[model samples]
Each structure stands twice: as C-alpha cells, then as structure tokens.
Target: MSWMTLSLTLIFVFIPLLLSKTLNLGLERDTIVAALRSTVQLIAVGFVLKFVFDSEHAVFIMLMVLLMIVAAVQNARHKGKAIKGITWKLFVTFVVIEVLTQTVLLGLHIVPATAQYIISLSGMVIGNSMVLAILFINRFTAEVETHRDESELILSLGGTPKQSINRQLMKSIQASMIPTIESQKTIGLVQLPGMMSGQIIAGADPVQAVQFQLLVVFLLLSTAAMTSVLLGFLSYRSLFTERMQLMKIDVE
Candidate 1:
C-alpha cells in the first residue's frame, strides 16, 4: 500500500484505541468511522490534484480549484450555523482571502501567470483562510447572540450597530488571527514548520528553503488575518439592521 493509505489505515485503527486507553475518552465508533471516511475522501482528492497539476490544462485546473473552494466554504460555513448570515460571511471570507493571496503571489512573482501556480498558491492560502473564517464566524456570531440584548440597549442609547458590536467584533477578529500570529512568532523556535523542514530534508539548501517558507508564512499571515476580519464584518451585517434592530438570522 502507498504511504498515504497505510497511514490512513493506521490512524483509522489507532485513534479510537488510543482515545479509550490513554484518555478514556470516547469519540464512539461512529466518529472513528467518519474520520476514516474523511481519509478516503482526501485520498481521492490527492489523485485529483495529481491529475490537475500534471494536465496543465486551464479548464481542469480551474475546476479543481473551484472544487477546493467549495469544500473550504462548506467547512467554514458548517461551523457557524448559529450565525444566521453564513452565506454572506463565507462569500466575504473566500473573496477577500482569494484576492489578497492572488495579489500577493502575482505581485511578488512567487509563481507564473498560469493555472498551476494559481491553484497551488490558492490551495495553501485557502487552507489557512478556512480556519480563520471558521474561528471568526463562530466567535463573532456567538458573541452577538449572547450580548444581543446589550446591543439593543446600546442602540436605544444612540449607538449604531457598528458601534454596538464593536467590542465583540474586535474580540472575534483578534481571536481568529491569534493562531496565525502565534505560529508566525514561534516558527523555528517552538516548531520546525512542515514546508521548511520538508524542503530541507528533500536536499534543498537549508537557507533557500527557509526563505521560501518565510515567504509562504508571510502570505498566509496576510491571507488569514484579512479573511478573519472581513468575515467578521460580513457576519456582523446580518446581526443588525440599519434601524439598529437585531436581525434574527435563523440558521434553521
């Protein structure tokens, strides 16, 4: 079996036993089965990506990239079911990060004006962007939901929606970007990041690979931070109205 398959199987078999024996925690057999299903899905994606990269066909690459974006948005939106305006939040998050990451890559000449370059860069940034979007969406939505009465009070006292939820907005935005910022701060200190270490081990010059990894981190930092803040603002829009009334975005 391929390494990926072998690893997937090992994880499928090992995780539950480890959880039960080491922590006495239970994800249930159903959870373990679901995790294995995800592994199978990823394995399928690996095959599709190989075809996309090798084909160098614009249509194929675009389709693959679009599929990836759909998957990402679905994942991010799923976590924010309480945030009534999930679709809008997802659009803002995806669009902002896509534009920012694309601009950075093209402007910096990190990759050529080709499908391969665009797809690869977007995939990397999108992965980080999804996490950022989910983090901001969940927290911002929950905070607004919890403090909704306070927001109404503030509105009655002459505060705009923007002004009313400013505290929670800032909090969620900050919380979303904390992981990205901390990863940036701690790389090479607390951990040898995957890309850099992998490049070095693959016989590339250590210094050169480190430089490439730095550039990746720089792009991810901007992509993740921008996505979090933009998504948070978009989510805020559905929570309040022009008349400063709380808009009930019923996820159901």
Candidate 2:
C-alpha cells in the first residue's frame, strides 16, 4: 500500500473518535493517543526489524528478543505489582516461554533459525504470554482478595500455603486460558487470523498460509498454557509469609 492509502486508514481511527465524542464516553484523548503511539511505534519497529533481518547477526537477533522480553515484563508487571518481585517474575516467565518454544521449533527443524522467523515467532509468543500473565495476575489478585477469610481459616487449621491457595490459583489459571482456548475453537469459522490473511493478501498460496497459521495456532496454545501455569505458580508463593500464613495483598 502507498503512503496515501495508509493515511486513508485513519478513517477507521476517526470513526472511534467520533463515536466516543458523540456518546460522551470520554475516550477521545485515549483513542487519539493510542492511535498516534501505535503508528509511531510500529514505524520505528519496522525500521529496526529491517536492519536486524538484513544483518542476520546472532547478537542483533538476541538483542531484539531481549528487548521484547523486557518490554513485555514492563507492561505485565503493573498488573501484579501487589505481589512481591512481580517484575522479575514476569521477566523469567517471558524468557522461559521464549526459550522453551524456540528449543522445540529449532531443535526439530520445524522452522528456519533465521532472524526473520525467530524474531517474528518470539514476538507472538512473548506478546501472548504477556497478555496471559496480566490476565492471570488480575484474576488471581481478585480471587485472593475475595477469599481472604477462607484462606486464613485454612491456614489457621494448619493447612499449607499451597493447599490454602490451590483453589484460587487453579481457578485463575483456568480463567486466563479460557479466551485463548475458545478463540482457537472458532478460528477459521468465525474469522481469519491476521497472519494468514496478510500472507494471502501478499499473494502467498492459501495452503501455505494456512499451514503457517496452524503452526502459530499451536504455538499460541502452548504459550497460553505455559504462561498461565508458570506465572501462577511463581506468583502464588509470593502471596504468603515464610511462616505459612497468608499475607494481606492490597489489589488495585
């Protein structure tokens, strides 16, 4: 698409802004800021990705992946800041997700170990993991708050921290994973995924695009499961005291 065509896409943005104004939803400023930031950030990322792809240096590729993990951690940490050491927890979760996924993909020769494929897949894995982390933490915090008395009663009855929080933790993990699972159930029938649709628009064979999209779908399923389970396990421990008592968590 030309610059002019891209500029014309602002019509889509304006539609939301107009609705927000008419309905007095008070989202105009946020809508405008998000649109501007997305445009600027994506353009900057496009240039950086081009340079990294052209260089094909392992150092540059690793650096790009590191940046993604750092950014993902930063964005996800806020949702769980009430839990101690949430920043590092998110960092570790994203790194593990990246390492585990790449190991399987590259070890089996499922995809080329090139900057293009590695970075693209890393972006998807890290992004999805970050969202899952946020969802899990949000729900987990709410659960803890709601069940504080029950948890304390369990602790008073000599139950371990893990036993006390097991129900809430499992519920949070399952809740966070539901969206990813449900979306996959209706993927092709309800809508075409962006990656597959983009490839088809770029004149790639439909069969090839579908195959690639399926790979991504499978990768995302693993990403969602690992992210929720790992982050939940890592975070739940922080909600307790060394004395096996439930610590008070103030959730915002």
Candidate 3:
C-alpha cells in the first residue's frame, strides 16, 4: 500500500467521529485518542520488530516476550484491584498461557523458529489471554457483588469459601470464554480475520493463509479457556476472608 492509500484509511476514523458527534455519544475524544495511540504504538512496534528480526538472538526474544507479558499484566491488574495480589495473579496466568502456547508451536514444529513468527504468535497469545483475564475479573467481581447475600448464606451454613463462590466462579469463567468460542465457530464465514487478510494482501497463498489463521484460532481458544479457568480458580479465594466470610469489595 502507498502513503496515499494509508492516508485514505482516515475516512474509517471519520465515520466513528461523525457518529459520535451526531449521536452526542461523548466518544469523540476517546476515538481520537485511541486512533492516535494505535498509530504511534504500531509505528514504534514496527521499528522494534524490525530490529529484533535482524538480531534474532534468543535472549532478545525472551526479553521482548517478557515485556509483553508485563504490559498485559499491568493492563489487566486494574480490573481485579479488589483482589489481593492481582498483578501477580495476572502475571502468572499470562506467563503460563504464553509458555504453553509457544511450547506447543515450537515443540511440534508447527511454525519455524523465526523471530517474526514467534513474536507475532506471542502477541496473539498474550493479547487474547490478557483480555480473557480482564473479562474474568470483571465478571467475577460483579457476580460476587450481585450474589453477596447468597455467598454469605453459604458461609453461614458451614460452606467453604470455594464452595460458596464456586457457582460465581464457573459463571464468570464461562461468560469470559463464550465470546471467544462463538467467534471461532463463525470465523471463516463471518469474516476474514486480520492475520489471514493481511497475509493474503501481502501475496501469500490463500490456502496457506487459511491454515495459519486456523492455527491462530485454535491457539486463541486454548488461551481463552486456560486464562479464564486458571485465573478464576486462583482469584475466587481472594473474595473471602480468613474466617470464611465474604469480603466486601469497594468499587471505585
């Protein structure tokens, strides 16, 4: 694509701004901020990726992946601030998801051990897992708040914290994972995902692009399940006090 073509993409941005203005949605500022941030971040990432691709050192790759995980944790931790040690919980959850996904890819030789493949796949893995983690936290917190009485009743009836919150925990995990599952179910028919479309535009064989897209979708599904279940189990306990009573969460 030429500079003109890239510049013309701004029209897409105008649609959102126009709708926000007409509807008085108060999203103009947010839309502009998001567009600007996305532009700047993608440009910076392009440079960093270029340099990493040239270097191809294992240590550099590890450092980059770790940085991505830290960013994911920071982005997700706020959603679960009511829970103690949420940052660590997010960090561990992302690390496990990323490692497991990468291990499968590399161990099975599904993808070549190239910087581009590793970094791109890692972004998808960590990004989806981060979103799932945030969703799980938000849902779990809301469920706990909504069912506080039921939880307390369970506790009063000699139920353990796990038993008291198990329903909410399962509900939260399922809620967070459903979108990923549903999207995958309709992936090919509903839309061409960015990865596949980008590859096809770059002149890759359509069949090859489809194969890669399928792999990514599978990875995302696995990540969605792992992130939700692992974080749900690890985090539900934080909602209870040592005396097995429900802790009051103060929403800011």
Q: Is candidate 1 or candidate 2 better by TM-score?
A: 2
* Candidate 2 lDDT, 1-252, residue by residue in tens: 999999999999999999999999999999999999999999999999999999999999999999999999989888887899999989988999999999999999999999999999999999999999999999999999899988989988999998898999999999999999999999999999999999999999999999999999999999999999999888888998788877778887
Candidate 3 lDDT by residue in tens digits, 72-101: 998988888999999998998999888888
Instruction: Report, for all candidates in order, the number of backbone clashes.
Output: 0, 0, 0
Q: Candidate 3: where is the Cα deviation over 4 Å?
A: 15-28
Q: Which regions in candidate 1 have their CA more than 4 angstroms from the true location?
A: 1-35, 114-116, 247-252
Which should have the higher lDDT, number 2 or number 3?
A: 2
lDDT of each: 0.78, 0.94, 0.91
Model 2 quality (TM-score): 0.96
Q: Write the per-residue lDDT of candidate 1 for residues 61-180, one digit (tens) a residue.
A: 768767778888888777777666686668666866787677777888877867756876788888888888877777777777778788778888988889888988998888888889
Top candidate, metric TM-score: 2
Worst 10 residues of 2 by lDDT: 243-252
Instruction: Give the backbone clash total of model 2.
Output: 0
